[model samples]
Target: MSLVDFSSDAFIVAFFLYCFGFLFYGVAIIGRKFSNRNPDEHMHKWGRIAFITSVLGFIAHLTFFFTRWAGGGHIPTSNMYEFMTFLAMMVMLAFIVVYAIYRKPMLGFFTLPLTVIIVAFAAVFPQEVQPLIPPLQSIWLKVHVTTAALGEAFFAVGFAAGLMYLLRVVDFNSKEKSMRIQQRWVEFTLYVVVIIIAFIGSVFAFRGMGYEAHFIQETVEISSQGVESTTTDDVKYSMPPIVKPYNSQVQSMDSFLGMKEPLFETPSWMKGVDAARKLNTIVWSIINGTILYGLIRLVLRRRIGAAIHSVMDGVDPEDLDEISYRAIAIGYPIFTLGALIFAMIWAYIAWSRFWGWDPKEVWALITWLYYTAYLHLRLSRGWHGKKSAWIAVIGFVVVMFTLIGVNLVLVGLHSYAGV
Candidate 1:
């Protein structure tokens, strides 16, 4: 077998192992409440195990990607499967580096499950091999997308960290209220993770059980007012044997006609429009995440951790304000350089245009504007502390929209992402 075939099989096994690890980790987390367990309880022993397993998983993930690239004779990020895999891998690697510096294993608690999620979603997309189209033959495809994805991955880390910070800072006077908060977070997390896993997992599990996407084409007759319109028959549309992610590179006219008929035999009119495959990558981002997280704080109704609360209880609000200011000072410029300048330069090289008002591009502009306003609010109007942190959090929502929702929902020239 080719190296890629071997690698694909290996990656599949690695994915299974990763899923098992997550189950154990989740059990361990819940077990903490029951058995008075701490993630760092064994300190050295559990940490070592976590590190080894994570590193091994990361290596196998990289091997799958590199092997695929070797077989294809190009970058592996040519489709949604490849791109999602790349992004998730980048996030995991970033988490490892951050954990090394921060010495915080809690971050892994969030990152690992999320990595599984993106990988699971990727499994739903088509994985069949296809040659690269002419437009994808540019050096910047590697440069622009890679750096941008890494940058987004960094911000994702920041978002997760920031959420943890929020949770740590929050508290409730009543145990009842606190329990409610914890339960809510757990339920939301479960909803998201389960839905994605079930969607993709079912597809793979059934396929493994010898089921497949069956595509067949046939014509039907329609009679209107006794005028029979016999659709020229003998063309059967069936799903691809293996469902792969949608490829925007396919000529739409030819691509549409190639789809298998609706499994339930819906009328042709019921077939959905194939504009941009998915645009949710950018849409869910604008739903006021800062407000949501902030509102949670309001409901919690008291300071959370005694240690953190005590540390903040006496410090001048201005000092805390300055710390937040410094974080924004460091993050804003880097975000601009990564999301806007790098992206535009890459787009110009690849698409022959600096900007096309693609939904993803537009959301990136929205993110920039959000942060710009944040800086202005901070420096000029003296916004700081709770307000400033709130803005920083909001900025992340914009960034997420730019990074994920756009690719998932919005359709445009940047549909390469939806692939």
Candidate 2:
């Protein structure tokens, strides 16, 4: 196989192995009653075995990551596919590091599933490698993004810890909080998320079946006389666009939604029509995610979180709370150095301006400030337990918005990160 092909095959194997390892971890935690003399000893021993499995998976994954780098002739952080995959790897690396320090199997239980989510997310984007664009032709691309991803991965661990801490400490069974996180709303939101995933899945699935939304789009092409003229270009939405912009015209309208323009046009500045075109993909993913979630709920007949919560009875709330704080303390500075300082230098080199207030740059700052507030509120104002945990959780949300949201929702110099 070509290095890239080998890398792809190895990545699939490693991905499945990670899933299997997570299942093993689940068994370690809750399966002790079924087949063990001493529950505690069995849990510990099985947890170690699960960790070993994860380690093996990580090695395979890391090997694939590097092989991709070698095949691509640069680090794999320039596109959504590469960045998402690399981000998952970084999260796994952070989990392994924290697990080594604390030997907390609970951490893996919390963090590993995120990689699965990330893998699903990465699969949504195109994987074909393109030549590096001018803005990304810098050594700083590797340095800035890698370090920033590592920093965010550490913060992601804090997010997992904070979530666990909240689950353990918060009385979700309480009437008021339960009412606030109303079952209907929660279910609805989950449905939306899952439907989105499913919609995206359908796109990939149908594309494999040679399905596409055949459409005609107007384009400007420079002629041999160096004069630009408007021309009609035939386009296809591989994922089956659910809707196109109001102005878009399709010559051969099919049953597929993309063959016709949407009734509404998206109001966007930079991305414009491209932004409108993307709505279908997003909408489809939400609907897709919702359907898949419903099927899962049907099978389990219990809220998945609550079911997972039952297995985590052995988790210590205080430990999770403390570790969450410690993780932020470690990650914040690293994030600043990479996402800010190094990023500025790269920006200066690429854009001839250190601070253009690009959406990505602004969100990175927002993330930094959010975490800073988290630390300040925690250490100075004596915030701890539930409050601090919530901050950590929100801080990571801001971090994600910076990484994923900015790439999707806005257009800027960091366009390379978008697929």
Candidate 3:
């Protein structure tokens, strides 16, 4: 087999091991005999074993990385799919380092699923390893992006830590029915995350092997001079859309059960067809996610968080808070130097400008500022408990927007990230 093939196989093996390790870690925290016995007595051993399996998975991930690097003749950090995989691997590595310090098995329960979800999300993008284009074909590209991802991985772990801290300390059991409903919604959001991951994964898994469906789309395009033009073309997509794009001519009688063409035309500058295609695909993914979530709710007959809470009897919110702080403390400076400093260096070489206030650059600054405020409140003002956790959670949301939202919603210098 080719090195790329080997890498793909290794990655698949690693994914299975990570899932198993996730399960094993859950078994560890819940203990052998539950409420009758001491929590995490003999069960801690299982935690160690789970860590071992994850380490084994990480080793395979490493193998995949090196093999793919050797095969591609460049680092596997160019595209979103590759970057996400690399980021997930780094998050696992960071989790391992933190686990060594704190020896917490429950951390794995949160972090592993996240890693799985991220890696699975990576599969949503095209997996083809194309040669690096100009501007992107730079040595500093590797240096700048690599450090940024490593820093972000620790930040991702901080998110997990913060989320766990909130779950444990959150006053969800309120007598007020509205407050209780809000709590259930919060719990429901977690499942939604997983559902989106699964929905995206299923789409890419089946369709990734080069699936395509063509539809004659009646696209309404607005020109720069405020001229409206209606153009029709056969558009191709990898996944089957439940809803067609706005004003699309239907050659094939596919399902348009609840889809409606919008009255407004696409923006003048925007590539209307591509925008429509992405929108349609995303809508279908959400539809699939809702169905999957409904099935999960039907099966469990309770909120996912409540079900997970059954085994969270012995978890420590304080430990979670501390780890979240520490992870951010470690990641911040590294992020500053790489994402900002080295990015400026690379940008100067590429665009002959240090900062142009591009959407990406703006969001990067926003992320930095958000985390900076987080550190300030955490250290100086002594926002150590629930407030800090909320900050950490919000910080990651900004990070996600920087990483994903900017790439998709706002096109700029970092448009390659959309790949």
Candidate 4:
């Protein structure tokens, strides 16, 4: 096979390995109670097995990265698919480092599943390698994207640990107002994760069935020379349309589940390229996510958070909190270097400006500032445990919005990254 083909195969192997690692980690955590052997010994043996599997998966993932780099003639991080896959690999790397330091099996229980979800999510985007755009043709593209994603991967690990800390410590059965509020927010966070999984499922299901719809969207632009120009472009969807593009005509649409046409037109305010498609995807995610959540709730007859919290009974909240803090602390400076310094250097070379108020740039700044405040509150205000964990969790939301939401909802210099 060609190196690119081999890389693709290696990526598939890595994905399965990660999934197996997650399952093994789950067994290490959950099977201990059921095993005939001593609990500590059982966990130790399974955790060791899981760790080895994860390390092998990381090696396979690295193989994929290097082979793809060699074959594709550029780093495999120029698009959403490549970037997300790379981020997943980096998360595994970060997890490995933290796991070695802490030797906590429960950490793998949380982190491996996250790495699996990320790798799966990355599959939702197109995987075909394309030539880098003119703006992305600099060496800084490699430096900036790789470093930024690596930093974000550490934040992802912190998020997993922080979330686990919350689960371990939160009073899921409490009737007190404060605890109830925390319970609801934790459930909401889990629902958001479910939504992401639902999105990946929905995309793959439709893609497998070869579902498609087409539209021709028109745009009118006024130039600096006082000239008005009109353009029309073709937009395609792999999933059924819940909303059509603004000011667009349907070219062809495949009927889905007896729905032949879009239920609504996109708002005029959402003028970003393929904004309607993105909105449709979001709508489907919520719909499918809610249904899946309902099914899980039905099976357990308890809140999802409560169900998860049961498995977290013996895990120390303090250790999780410390891991979360340390991971973020390590990531913050790297993020500053990658997202700000290197980005500015690249921006100057590309746009002749170090700072532009583009939506992406603005959100990146907002993310940096939010995390800066997190560190300040953590150090200066003495936030720890729940408060610190909450910030770590929320900070990841900020990081994700900076990475994804800006691309989907706003048009800017970084729009070429795709949805």
Pick the TM-score winner.
4
Off by over 4 Å in 4: 220-230
lDDT tens readout by residue for model 4, 1-419? 88999999999999999989989999999998899999889999999999999999999999999999999999999888898899999999999989989999999998998988989988887888889988899999899998988889999999999999999899998999999999999999999999989999999999999999999999888999999999998999888999999999999999988999989999998876677888899999999999999999999999999998998767878899999999998888988999999999999999999998999889888888988998999999999999999999999999988888887677899977774
lDDT digits (tens) for residues 100-139 of candidate 3: 8888888998999888888788877878787898988888
TM-scores, one per candidate: 0.64, 0.87, 0.89, 0.96
RMSD to the hidden true structure, all candidates = 9.9, 4.1, 3.3, 1.7
Select the stronger candidate by lDDT from 1 and 4: 4
Model 1, 110-131: lDDT tens digits are 5677777778777777776667
Cα displacement (angstroms), candidate 2, residue 136, comes to 2.0
Using TM-score as the yardstick, the better of models 1 and 2 is: 2
10 residues in a row with least lDDT, candidate 4: 410-419
Q: Give the higher-lDDT candidate: 1 or 3.
A: 3
lDDT of 2: 0.77
**The candidate that achieves the highest lDDT relative to the unseen native structure:** 4
Stretches > 4 Å off in candidate 1: 13-17, 20-41, 166-194, 201-272, 275-335, 371-400
lDDT of each: 0.57, 0.77, 0.80, 0.91
With candidate 3 superimposed using the best TM-score fit, by how many Å does residue 155's alpha carbon deviate from the native? 0.9
Which clashing pairs does model 4 show?
A: none
